[model samples]
Target: MVFFNKVGKVALGSRLRLMTAIITDDAAKVYELYEADFMPKWFPVFYTLTEEREITITEIANEIGHSQPSVSKIVQEMITAGLVNDNLKTTDKRRNIVALTEKGLILSKKIKLQCIDVEAAVESLISESNHNLWAALEEWEFLLEQKSLFKRVNEQKKMRESQDVQIIEYTPEYQEAFKALNEEWISTYFEMEEADYKALDNPKEYILDKGGKILVALYKNEPVGVCALIKMNDENYDFEMAKMAVSPKAQGKSIGWLLGEAIVKNAKELGASKLYLESNTILKPAINLYHKLGFEKVSGLATPYKRCNIQMELIIK
Candidate 1:
């Protein structure tokens, strides 16, 4: 109890396992009292086969929400116990179909009567509890399905890490960082094009001085990411999002997302109606990040960079 209290929510899996063990042990005792030779773990598969008459291993897994391998193992155990038969499909010999045997059918019929009393007993047990554990479990299952624990934890982690990150406007001191960050990613994937050097080598002269903005992300007071909102005189777009890069060490800190978001917000503040971007599909993560930032695929606009094979735009207005 002391350990669980100290660990708090971190012991969720342990608590769930303890609850499952208690319920499973009671089920085993019930089967023993009825003189039934069955394992509590087999109930889900057995019930599914009895209802479906015949189903493939994959189908059983889908129906019971268990992994195919787990369902296959349970089916094999039932087959060994002479309670089920595993047959290959006539049309597709590679596929297996499971069905209850005569022994299984007889046992299922006996269990049907047991289920009536068991359901009532479980309902009474629930009524005895302060809260409806069954309903709470259903809600927990739905919420977990909506967004997994992995994603939820990672979101919290990003939020915590992002607190250490600070987004600031372009300054002369960060000129080298802006150039190096973009050059690192560009050189890693493709050769730095003439247009890349023109803009990266002199961001202030080429971007900021010409009614544009550059945003820098500093992680723990170190420049880790940079992006630019290059103002454009195009009829469709007011700015072109360019030179976005996150240092490899700070990749998972959500700096890229924060920079993109800051760029968008800045563009809107500057009375920009739409933002444009150019990239190659080969850079999947960058393309995905653009999409997440509300950028949609667009064409008909020529680009100076040889590496630009795709173009996307975001409508801020």
Candidate 2:
């Protein structure tokens, strides 16, 4: 998300158009959209699915066009809220088939019906007062508009938002870049130790070995953020998140939140029910970010890493 200054000789009048305006949609709204637009109403007809019949995370993921892990995480939430259940499985029982609970079935039906009415009401408004509706919105945007302050803040945020960070499988060429990230955090923030070459074990390998994933956030040549999923527990849908570290240079740039969101989305893709994180109280902002992103605290200790002074877990599904 580097900003470039262009050399130009214009006669004091130049206007630059933005490529794309940012769309800020929070997790809850996204969840609501997913629940309202799809689910029982659509799924029943689309896939011949029903609350009574057995279902699998893979099937739902396919229907939703989302990663399997991400879909699993959502299913876990449904299960936790008693909207879904482990009602059936193959003879081995290792192959679990998810099913909707009574609550989920009822809630989806209610929402589907209510939103239908809401949309009808909105349509009536449009049919009755089209001009006033749009004009009111336009006047609101105009009245709410501030000058450079808003633009400056948004531009500053863009310094991190539109970065080209992506998921890459670990490789030797990437190994150095990986170790560079590790070496950057060698002792203090990166797992209490550091090494090079032979002793340098890239953390992503460990995470990958656990049926999870690794996603690296890159800014052109430099790696800025890294998150990994490590297998943790078998209870409450198993596996916890570990080895989440962002570059010091990228602090306050939303790198952590991006990584956090990535982990959640990735967890859902992986079919996880819950996500737990361990951190120290020293990282207040990190804790706040976790809370903002929907992680909650627990009474008893919940992590193996003693260095993790505070542990926060989120039921992803």
Candidate 3:
């Protein structure tokens, strides 16, 4: 036995391999002690054929969770040892079926009795363990089937980064993204008006060229939300927060909060003393977000869109 005390803990892969090697070597030694010609590596295929009577190489591979090539190699060795025979299917010459020979059947019966000893030894080892290792292994296999280990790890990574939303300034590459994101919500809630088209289609001319800024939220390097800070021509340093939209797929992931915080920061940086927005009361979530960001409800404000029934403003210090 190798001591891993210096290493402190053994890796999962190494531990599993070591356990398999130890059991295989012990089984091989038992077979040798009994003066049997069979090997431990041959048991899976030999025992399966003995019970199944006749089966194809592919079937054996599938039943035993081994590669077809590996199973085929073992079958070949069995054939060379005169323990099994292979015959081509009469209806399909391409397919070959395998069956145990007389010698194989006799050897299988002897091995069956030996397996009782192996099972007793395994049970004794399990009794010495602090916990039920077999039960733990079964539960682990079930979970792997439900969701693979790789997928579970990726989901954990996504959950951790869900709060880490990133905001980026709009560029020529994101031109289509800005338009698509805005149009998705606008077209869904209400019909797109002429003003909507002008702003969504030509953001550079209407927003950027007029000293306004557009910010896009990025999650995993993909544009998922957008908002624009439009400079108002009024004497006061006030800006209109417009065209805020988060992709439906990314709605519940806090991308909207990130975009809202970013647009406010950008507005303050651009010398704005107040930020105003025009929205519909039907948009309860958006309205709630605005309220959470300290935007106060205000009375009368002129809005070009017919959908604007609610107006709010935030004072920037």
Per-residue CA lDDT of model 3 for 204-309, tens digit only, reads: 9999999999998888899999999998976643799999999998876767777888899998888888999989999999999999888988867667898888
Clashing pairs in 2: 68-269, 69-268, 69-269, 69-270, 69-271, 70-268, 70-269, 73-317, 77-317, 83-101
Cα lDDT listed for each candidate? 0.92, 0.61, 0.87
Q: Judged by lDDT relative to the true structure, which candidate is superior, 1 or 2?
A: 1
Candidate 2 global Cα RMSD: 23.1
Question: What does candidate 2's lDDT look like per residue over 77-162, in tens digits?
Answer: 55665666774757756666876666666666756566576568667877897476656756755765754445756766766564
Q: Ten-residue segment with the worst summed lDDT in candidate 1?
A: 88-97
What TM-score quantifies how close candidate 1 is to the native fold?
Answer: 0.90
Q: Which model is ahead, 1 or 3, in terms of TM-score?
A: 1
Model 2 ranges off by over 4 Å: 1-156, 159-161, 167-169, 179-183, 189-205, 299-302
**Which model scores highest in lDDT?**
1
- RMSD (CA, Å), candidate 3 to true, equals 11.5
Error of 2 at 97 (Å): 79
Q: Which regions of candidate 1 deviate over 4 angstroms?
A: 88-95
What stretches of model 3 exceed 4 Å from their correct place? 1-10, 88-95, 160-164, 167-215, 218-317
Model 1: lDDT to the true structure: 0.92
lDDT for model 3, please: 0.87
